[model samples]
Target: MKTEDEWQHCLTPEQYDILRKKGTEAPFTGKLLHNKEKGKYICAACGMELFSSEAKFDSGTGWPSFFDANKENIATKRDLNHGMIRTEVLCKHCSSHLGHVFEDGPNPTGLRYCINSASLDFRK
Candidate 1:
């Protein structure tokens, strides 16, 4: 496994900033926002599998939003930053901040797992 320092060296400054520091990438700038493939999205920090391609959908939100995460693969916490209350999602094992959850989502769950591409590693 790559150590934390190795990960820092492997990713670019912008990737490290957003993946490790919970920073946001500019809207409409994520490559995965329009990806349509059979794969899994893992945590860039620790390689923990987070979401499946089957759960992905287009929300016109300019980010990768999933209807659900892999079972027990993610952890969530209440975020009170940015002057608003939101649920912050993290990789369960790595605790790397992925993104936030909102109630406005499509279908069965009604949950939008809006995530930053910088925080995820796609595996086909």
Candidate 2:
């Protein structure tokens, strides 16, 4: 495990807040929110493959929406913050906060991975 100083040294403030402190970016304000590219979305903290371009879709939620995830790449836990029940998604390798997952999504998987762009890196 990395020390807080080490994580702070390598990660940006936004990334640290979102990934470590479980903060969220504003809706429709992410850099990759409208990205229609072909590549893999990797974890910013550990470079673990998280999502594929093919599974990405427009949820119109103003975040990076993916209907599916890479094999065993993420970990989820029940979150009861803000008087709402939600699943908090995290990087399986680094335990960094990636985003949340909801069941109201498109077919095949019916999952919406509303991810923060700062938590991911694209590799084309």
Over 4 Å off, model 2: none
In order, the Cα lDDT scores of the candidates are: 0.87, 0.92
In candidate 2, what are the lDDT values of residues 1-124, reduced to their tens digit?
Answer: 8988899989999999998999998989888888888999999998999999999999988889999998598999999999999999999999999999999989999989999999999999
* Candidate 2, residue 26: how far the Cα is off, in Å: 1.0
What would the C-alpha RMSD of candidate 1 be, to one decimal place? 1.8
Provide the TM-score for each candidate, comma-separated: 0.90, 0.97
Stretches > 4 Å off in candidate 1: 1-7
Query: Each candidate: how many clashes?
Result: 0, 0
Please write out the lDDT profile of model 1 over residues 1-124, one tens digit for every residue.
5566976898788778886788898878998888899999998877889999998999998899998888598889999999999999988886778999899988888999999988888999
Estimate candidate 1's alpha-carbon lDDT, on a 0 to 1 scale.
Answer: 0.87
